[model samples]
Structure formats: structure tokens, C-alpha cells
Target: MVKGEVCSEGLGPCDDTCNSKCTSKYPNGKGSCDSISNSCKCFYQCLQPKPEICNVGIGTCSTACNDQCCNGNCAAKFPGAYEGHGVCYNVGPSIYNYCVCIFKC
Candidate 1:
């Protein structure tokens, strides 16, 4: 669990007004707080709707999708993930701030 930073390194604002939520970069996230802004970044990986964890060597990716979005088990299938079948597919660059997977089935 990440604890939001209360101190602002003397830049200013140390009161309740300065209270912010922790931010995370990865989905199925496995890291710590990313204090970039005020909104609490949803650590998708920690919750669900996990993002792509690519197996670069195999040119394939895998993850579990959000149950609310699809009726299926937490998937670990290949890319081209399909709903009701448990799979997720991704495309584009490797340095995405967020992954927008397309599911079919």
C-alpha cells in the first residue's frame, strides 16, 4: 500500500489542502507511490483490469481483465484477448502511459 506524500519539499502547502492520492504507473501494478498530482491513480494491476504484461521474447502479452467489463475468469491467455473467453490483446508502442486493449468474442 502506498502512502501519499504529505510534505511538499518546502515548495509550499503542507496542510489538508495539500493532501493528495498516490499514483501508480503500471496496471497489475507492483510498485509504489507516484506523487505526480492530486488524483488517486488507480493501480489497475492491484485491483483488476490488469494491463498487458508482454512476453517480448514470444511477442505475446497476457493479463486479467476487469470482471465488470467482461464476464470471464481473470485471464492469462495470449493477446487478442476475448471477452466471455478470457483474453486480452494490445497494439502500438511499448511506452504507453496507459493501455487501451481491444477485446472480441
Candidate 2:
């Protein structure tokens, strides 16, 4: 997975107001919305015990939700992803940096 990067690159449903766009320009997310700058900034972080391979950051766009957020098996759905996810845990200037497949939890 990629290190020192944010993965909320997808632009999801504007009405949903939960998962918005991640930071990467070429890569992607299944995500979480945090209160940043008084905005419900929705984005994705990588998940782990690091995968056997790496990442494919799916649903990192505005398409995941039409009415609401998309929920289910991410690995089973989006594959062949060329990009990588983020780090799981960090000690310097990074928190749980891994982007997980977002589902109703």
C-alpha cells in the first residue's frame, strides 16, 4: 500500500453528505466522513493486516451512492485496481492511514 497519502479521492452522492472525495488525483476509496473545517468531509482510508497483494481502492468516486452509500463486499466487487491503499497504522504525522472497504457498520 501507499504511504503518507489520503485516499478519499472519490466524489460520492452530494445529498448523502457522508462519503465525499478522497485526496489522491490518480488513485482512490470506501470511506469515512470526518468533521474537517466544519464540513462533513467524507473520504477513505486503507485497511489491513496488509493484503496478500496490496490495494485496488474501489468506489472512489461519485458513483457509490445515488440515494445512499454503497455497502457490501468491496474485494469481491472491485478488482484489478492498479493503485494502492494507505498504511494501516503510523507513528509520525499519520494515524490509521489504511483505507477500508466502507460498509454499514
Candidate 3:
């Protein structure tokens, strides 16, 4: 679950108006008005797992080679995992020299 705050308008005390605004914004979320901040605190379930990163450090390779390496490393690190992939990035003065694995947490 995640908690987020949204600004509330009007010069009156915090009331059900904040709840209505939050509910309209996030139908699946619950909200409450905070008197201290005059904002709406919303709590909702996370829709997706956060992405995990694995840096393979500096390396020299082509896009295809980097993709293969990242995929292999990510697979080794997260075996039997579903819904994950790898990406190749350039770093420093060299281009296409970094491997990063982005996978589901």
C-alpha cells in the first residue's frame, strides 16, 4: 500500500470535501482530511510491484551482446521469475558499455 497527500482548497476546516476529492481521484483508495496540513491523505493498494535494479558494472559490448548479458545475469539473480526484463545503457565516455537488469521486485 502507498500513502499520498494531495492539496485541498477552501478556507474552512477540513471536512468530507477532501474525502470526496480523493475518492474521485482514486476510486480504489481511502482518504481522510488532515487538519494540520489541510490536505487529503490517501491510502491505496499498489497496482504493481516495484522494479528492482542490478548494475552489472562497466563493460564493453554491443547492444545485442549487452542485452544477452543483462538477461543472463538477471535470470541468474532472479531465477523462476515472471514479468521482468533487462536493458543496456551507455555510461561515462563510452557508449553501450553498461548492463542493467530491471526486474520485478
Q: Choose the strongest candidate by TM-score.
A: 3
Per-residue C-alpha lDDT of model 3 across residues 1-105, encoded as one tens digit per residue = 111212222323566676666567657656676555565665443344443322333345575566777767656654555333555655444553666544443
Q: In model 1, where is the ten-residue run with the lowest total lDDT?
A: 1-10
Lowest lDDT block of 10, candidate 2:
82-91
Instruction: Show where candidate 1 strays beyond 4 Å.
Output: 1-33, 44-78, 82-105
Score every model by TM-score: 0.17, 0.20, 0.34
**Once superposed on the true structure, which residue ranges of model 3 sit more than 4 Å away at CA?**
1-65, 82-84
| Candidate achieving the largest lDDT | 3
Give the per-residue lDDT digits (tens) of candidate 2, residues 2-103: 332333433443334343343332234534443332333334444444433333333332333321232233434443352222222221343323234422
lDDT of 1 at 70: 32
* Comparison by lDDT, 1 against 3, better one: 3
Looking at model 3, residue 94 earns an lDDT score of: 51
lDDT of 1: 0.27
What's the lDDT for residue 40 in model 3? 62
lDDT of 2: 0.34
